[model samples]
Target chain A: GESVGLHLPTLSVQEGDNSIINCAYSNSASDYFIWYKQESGKGPQFIIDIRSNMDKRQGQRVTVLLNKTVKHLSLQIAATQPGDSAVYFCAEGRDSNYQLIWGAGTKLIIKP
Target chain B: EADIYQTPRYLVIGTGKKITLECSQTMGHDKMYWYQQDPGMELHLIHYSYGVNSTEKGDLSSESTVSRIRTEHFPLTLESARPSHTSQYLCASSDFMGSRETQYFGPGTRLLVL
Candidate 1:
């Protein structure tokens, strides 16, 4: 069963600091990846996405890095804020029918 | 903003009750998906539809069923809700925008089987 998984269950960060969330995927056939931010009692929101051909992609204050060699993916958020606290999840997708494989989320906690 | 909507944001029902979670999207997307997620857990795909009159089960084995009679609406029905079915249901829709298909999600419905 090919799946996506996160390295940490929770991450505590202070305001104005940079936060990094790591993910590992088992499927080599996956070509696209996405990061989602899910707040309490809400659905997951799109954050950033990266394709396998590229190594890094940046958007606003968020950046997504993909390493196909190690099958690793990471999301970095700059200037963490209280509003940035949420559960972050990484999803992997293949070319067949565009079905996405989800990873267990990592809780991001911001300390004021 | 995405035009996806889900009804009954929160639900608390007894065991063996029948329940249907309604999901509708005005984005005119050809793809729709249903996912079940527990608190602080990963989302499991339960069902999905490629288009109107097309429905398929996802990676997860779920007791619920879904119908795609209309392109903009996809509803999931549970014949007998049990304690194990207590979870959050999320609906999403995506257009056939070539290779990069970004899925827009709706506010989820939280279910509690008492």
Candidate 2:
């Protein structure tokens, strides 16, 4: 089955430094991608998203880079903070589809 | 930031017990979804609804059922919960208008069947 997966199960970053999380998808027909953050004991929260037509999108302190040719996506967060400690998931979907293919998730840990 | 909410953040019940997980969204989105996830695992779609009085099964097969009586309310019911049914259930909604496909999620309900 086509699925989205993370490059690593966990990533550690120093406070005040930048952090990057990588994801790989197997479906080429997917036209939409999104990143979500889930805190402990909480549901997933929307972080950012990008369409296949665009290669990159930026938020307040986050940026999502999509590489359609390689089926890879990456999320970069600047100035990592303790509040940023959570599990991050990447999901892919088609523009006309209602459901998304979710990745297993990668835990982000902040070190002071 | 989203107005979606879920009741009974955590629950511990015995086997063969009937339970209902409540979910509601004030956004009045036309699309709603239910997903089951284990600790540190990926999400599995259990059910979803297109709108009021409209429902459909998701990719994963489950012993649970769902109902969408209004645009803001969607609930999931389990006839008889087993230990294997223990997991975190999440509810989400999205507006079908435009090219926005982002889903806003509720807090989620964690069930522990013993």
Please state the interface RMSD for every predicted structure, separated by commas. Answer: 1.2, 1.1
Q: RMSDs, each prediction?
A: 1.0, 1.1
Off by over 4 Å in 1: none
Docking quality class, candidate 1: medium
Q: Residue A47 in model 1: shift from native, Å?
A: 0.7
DockQ of 1: 0.79
What digit string (tens of lDDT, one per residue) describes model 1 on residues A23-74?
9999988879999999998899988888889999999999999999999999
* TM-score of chain A as modeled in candidate 2: 0.98
Q: For residues B1-114, what per-residue lDDT tens digits would candidate 2 score against the true structure?
A: 899999889999999999999999999799999999998789999999999999999988879999999999999999999999999999999875456587889989999999
TM-score of each: 0.97, 0.97
Cα-lDDT of candidate 2: 0.93
True contacts kept of each: 0.79, 0.71
